[model samples]
Target: MTLSVSLQHAFPGVSLDVRFDAPQGVTALFGRSGSGKTTVVNAVAGLLRPDQGRITLGDRVLFDAAQRQNLAPHRRRIGYVFQDARLFPHLSVRQNLLYGRWFAPKAARRAEFDRVIEMLGIAALLDRRPGLLSGGEKSRVALGRALLSEPDLLLMDEPLAALDEARKAEILPYLERLRDTFALPILYVSHSPAEVARLATTVVMLEAGQVTIAGPAHEVLADPTGARGFGQREAGALITARVSDRQEDGLTRLDCGAGPLWLPGITAPAGAALRLQILARDVMLARTRPEGISALNILEAEIQDIVAADGDGSAVLVRLQLAPGAGDKTAPEILLARITRRSVSALSLAPGLRVFAVIKSVAVAPGAVGPQAI
Candidate 1:
């Protein structure tokens, strides 16, 4: 079921007016801090009253200002996860999860207790209190609690923001599992590009309380000027590749839409598909396939588009389409590379011009790699 939201609200210094439809998968509310990501989610969760708006889940109306209808938070059947784990300090982990289940209407209770524990890997910590758990453990329990609520819609407001790098890495896989295993719509608020690349099926880019760009994750991130909302450093594309083999040299081979790519290390076994995020800043373009380059990964590509990089003329972002494989009928695979204006001028880059995308084997971040849905 699609979630449709059109809201108008006002703060002391800023106003919020935006609308979007979230399809069945994870729809990310992504933007910089104070970009109104949280406000939009709050309105949807019935936590914030909008000045005027209409919110609906399929045919069910949660809020309609003109009709004077608004469902209370508990009545909305939505589960929320905040930045902090917020597990109960006085209760054991299992008890805290059951507490969430308690709020779920008996008719709406679909999440099984033991299954949630197993899925989140929290069975071992069932007896521990919040104070005794590590950051990652606490996060898993918090997510389990939300799942146990058996919500039709899940609202996660930067759930990983409070964790350190190690902790964030630990919980990301579980988060991915939640997205893949559950049959619920998720409204996730985040500004991190890596997280969005790995998890978002659809992206709604908010700028100063308005929708700037909204589309599929790959289309939005692969846009030549996508850096408008995601600063240059964070702009990137996500690619799904299946592991073909692990060579004796230690590098792993991945068969992606762009053809075979060799990365430093990939632990997933053969035939396992993985999502990899490639930042525009880490990609380099070559006019021709340079021979004997240090970069082990190179793909033949054709220039698809070009636009100013970072809204400045000093540099440009070139969108490259991988040369399609024989009989391939899927959408063209895209990659973005940031380069100086001089490079574009010297190479005479233009639409339809052939080139090579050169990337180092180690440029891929292991933390950003996650299992792709089959």
Candidate 2:
């Protein structure tokens, strides 16, 4: 299923003219603050009427300004998970979840209550009230309630924004499970590059009020000009990798376009496919392979392009394409490294020049690695 939206909304000084289709799996609305991420999601959920445009899921028309049709939010069959849990304080977890199921049409009740509880790992908290649960627990309960509603499309507006690091970590795995298991399309709003890198299959980036960029997660992140949207500090490349082996000294090996990579704190089992995020700031480049390097992971690549900051900043983002891993025939993947303009000049780095990308094994935190959503 796909969600097509074309919206035109004006808010005094800021106006939005946005359009995009959210395909199956998680489609993330990624951009800086005030980028209209929430506004677009709100329009799709029928929370607010756009000045003009149409919104459709499959053949159903949820909103059409020209036709004077505006479906009620309750009738739209879209599950919304806001930044806050928003569960009924007095109700137990089971009661809150069942409350959502009450709105489902009898014939369309496909998400069973027991299955949702198990999937969200909320069975233990069924009898507990929302007030008694931890932050992560509350988020899981809120998501479970939405799933129990049997929604055709799910809308998440910065669902993890309010959680602390621990809470965010605890809930991320459950969120991944939701995306992988659910066959319906999802519209997720997040401004964090790390979160977007973790969950998004398709990414639609909004800026001011317009769609600055939109495409598959890896392609969007690898866009050389994306620094303006994702910010220079957050620019990175998302690579598809498979766990080749688990090492003896607390490290995991992954096979990717960069060949074999060793990373710390990877808990996934061997043969598991996952996504890995490499921040530009974490990558160091060398014109030639050095012998006494302490970095465990080094890949041979050719410089594809170089992007210098628009202003006086000395930092530049150098794009590189790595050779495919052994027995891997897919196209080479892109990687980005941020180095000073002086370093670029000293190294004589330019497009088509071969170089060695030294990636610090410890720089990739456990949070930077996520399950492959496709």
Candidate 3:
């Protein structure tokens, strides 16, 4: 399924002019609080009407101001999960989930009730009430309710925003499973880089009521020029890897384009695909391979580009392409490094120059790793 949106709306302080196509998998509408991320999602959900342009899900036209066509929210065949669970306070979890089936046409309700419960791991909570469930449990139940609706597309407006770190961690795996198991296309709204890095396949970056960037999540996040959108400190690269082995010392070895990377506290079985985030701030660039270093991860890389120092002129961002070893040229990967302007000048770094990216094995926290795309 595909979602196409082109909208124009003007409010007091925000004027939104956005256009993008969200293919299968999660497409994250990412930006700050007032960046119009929710506005775009509301438009898609048929909750807010745009003054102009069109919105289409596959062949269905949800909105077209020029054509004088607009589908009411209930008729749009779209499921919405908000920041809050929004479950019926008096209803049991089972009843709350089954409530969605009432909106789906009998012929269109093909999503099995039991399957959604299993997928979201909410079967055990069926007899419980919203007040009795934890934040993560509530979110899962909310997700289950939405999935059971049998919508063509799912819209989540920062569903995890209200949760704390532990609660968010408890729910991420279920979200990943939903993405991989279902054919449903998700339009997810989030400002957290970690959430987007973990869940998004496509990323649409909005700034001040406009789309500043939209593309593959990895490319958009790794773009040297787009560091400011994601925040300088949070800027980083995503690597697709597979767990190759678990050492007796309690570290997991992953094989990627950059060769083997050792990470602590990873319990995924060998051969499991994973996505790892390497934050630019945690990387160090060296002109030559430094011997006898405490850092356990060093990869031969070539400078692809150098972003000039930020507004404060305190640091520079460097983009590097990992060089594949002999007889292995198919795998390609990119890494980003944030360093002082003085270091850039001292090393005389430039595009095409060979260097080593020094990374501490423990720098990649457990939260930075996620299940890879199936």
Candidate 4:
């Protein structure tokens, strides 16, 4: 269920044009408030008619200006979950969830209602009205409703925007589970980098109505083009890994494509796969292997690429292929590390230079899940 979209539209003063391919996993529409993220998604969902473009999911054509075809919102077979969790106030949670089945074709409604309810942990709220549920609870019910509809594509427009940090935290794991449990493609909209880091499989970056870059989550997130769209401080690398071992001293070890990563205070199972994000500022580089350091995970890597920052400081994004089994560099796993201008100049770093990357345990954030790149 791959989705491809290329669209151009006109607003009062800004023109919107973005083209990107979305994979089967959750594709994040990430940008600031007025960056046309929502506009592109709305066009895909049939809420906004793009002046020109084509949108297709596998074999279904939702929009094609060249063919003069535009499907209405209802007929699009896409379930939309807005920021407000727009559940019916008068209807019980059960009825609100069942409402989703009304639009689903008889043959297409194969998604089990009970399973979705259990997955979302909304079973207890089934008999209660939306008014009685908390913000997080209401959002879960909305998600269950969307799943019950068995949509081909799920469009979530800043679904966590309306909630506070506590409530947002409460719902994130459930969202992660949804991404893993279903085969449905999702176009998730968000301004929060944390949300993108935690949930995105593919990322389509947009600026004031223009597509900046689009690619795999880690690649795009680490690319300077994507990083510049956000502030330099927000620039970072997303790495995929799995929990290989856990220590009793509150440390977790991850087997990443680049190498093993050590993080502090994670409670995941030993075999649980995860995604790890390294903030640009948290990384330090070394020209040669240094002896005696507190850093637990140090990988010998060849610098594949580097990009200077806008002003005084430069952000050198080093692509690393981790030294493989028994300290072997021949079959190393690949990773990215962002170093500053001073370090780049001090070490005279160039592509192909060998360097040791030192990362701190607290620098990595949890809740990242993507396919391994090794």
Off by over 4 Å in 3: 329-331
Write down the worst ten-residue block by lDDT for model 2. Answer: 224-233
Model 2 clash number: 0
lDDT of model 1 at residue 353?
Answer: 96
lDDT value, candidate 3, whole model: 0.90
* Model 4: per-residue Cα lDDT over 1-374, one tens digit each: 88889899999989998898886778998888899988888899999889999999889999999999999998888899999999989999999999998878999777598788888998889899988999999999898888888788999999999999889888998888888878878999998888887888889888899878888887787777787665666667776577888888878788766667888767777777666667766677888876798878776777777776566555556666555546433434455666677777888988888888888776665543333322
Over the stretch 48-124, how does candidate 1's per-residue lDDT look in tens digits? 98999999998889999999999998888888999898888999998999999998888877649988898899888
Candidate lDDT values, in order: 0.87, 0.89, 0.90, 0.80
Model 3, position 38: C-alpha lDDT score: 91
Q: Higher-lDDT candidate among 3 and 4?
A: 3
Per-residue lDDT for 336 in model 4?
60
Position 359, candidate 1: lDDT: 85
lDDT of 3 at 1: 82
Between prediction 2 and prediction 3, the one with superior TM-score is 3
What does candidate 3's lDDT look like per residue over 144-205, in tens digits? 88888888999999999999999999999999999999897899999999999899999899
Q: List the residue pairs that clash in candidate 2.
A: none
| Residue-by-residue lDDT tens digits, candidate 2, 1-374 | 88999999999899999989998999999887898999899999998999999999999999999999999999999999999999999899999999989878899887488888888888899899998999999999999889888999999999999999999999999989999998999899998888888898989999899998888888888886665567777788988799988878988899886688999998889889988999998999998897797898899999998887446769888888997667778888999898999999999999999999999999988898998885
